[model samples]
Target: MTLGHSTRLIAVAFALAGPFGLASQPSWAEPTQGWKSYIERDYQAAEKHWRTDVARGNPNGAFGLAILAERAGDAKGATEWYEKAALGGVPSAQVLTGQRYAEGVGVERNPVRAYAWFARAMAAGVPNAEKLRDRLAATMTPSQIKEADALAETLAKP
Candidate 1:
């Protein structure tokens, strides 16, 4: 589906929230609260809801908060939460974390680390991962690329 820049960003955040975007799963008794507020563009409400969810140790909530923080210009908050959710196996969050590392936005510059994250997210089957990996590779030396590939391989394992 086509999305505007803002919607596309939201979609990436929500894409991993459930099997579908902004739609709660039957597995949750109260439905996904963040999705509702996010769909309505009530980001403050969404942030509140996601914060609640995050406190409950929900990976989706962590991912949602990361996106909202990014939208709200809290790059550090976004980066922290993205790393948290990424470790929990949120593919989109993994991609976002990789991008952050690649750009040094709210994080230290580390191309090798960024390439590793892209590799991990790619292994997780995120869309456009191959393209992202290739783009970063262009800025890397052959040895750095090889190191990143190995690191990605290591991280990709269960």
Candidate 2:
């Protein structure tokens, strides 16, 4: 290798080695350009890109696949991937999961659970979550709302 490249590689290796050594360094996965493929209207390529990370529980891959599934009219597949991404901490996936729960789409309708998911999205800094939470709250009775509010607070905690 060139001296410059070798120096950079050495620096990176040292950086990756922490106080606890290499074992303490965070593991990284390869770049998966799933979103780019999906945006280009290429479902096949998007699927291929995203599949590389799905087994590793990458939220971006799950979220991209969810969008692709939805575009292809596969509600079941969409919900499944949405749930995976949501659990993996994707804010959009959390919002979508909330909507699904509220509407009984590919899952049971449960407003309380929906509210919690919305709150979780809000906690994760998804700005659209507030409106959805407020709208859903309007349909609930005072007691149900209290429960949902409590759930929201609980879900918001780290």
Q: What is the C-alpha RMSD of each candidate to the true structure, in Å?
A: 4.4, 12.6
The residue ranges of model 2 lying beyond 4 angstroms of the native Cα positions read 1-31, 146-158
Q: How well is each residue in 1-158 modelled by candidate 2, as lDDT tens digits?
A: 44443234324323322221111113323335765676566779989878776776566677677767776667888888877776766666778778888998888799998988887776766666878888998898888877877876655232
Q: lDDT per model, in order?
A: 0.74, 0.67
TM-score of each: 0.75, 0.70
- Could you tally the backbone clashes for each prediction? 0, 0
Model 2 lDDT on a 0 to 1 scale: 0.67
Which pairs clash in the backbone of model 2? none
Q: How well is each residue in 46-154 modelled by candidate 1, as lDDT tens digits?
A: 9899888878766668878877777778889889988887766666777878889999998997888889888877777676776888999999999999898887776
Best prediction by lDDT: 1
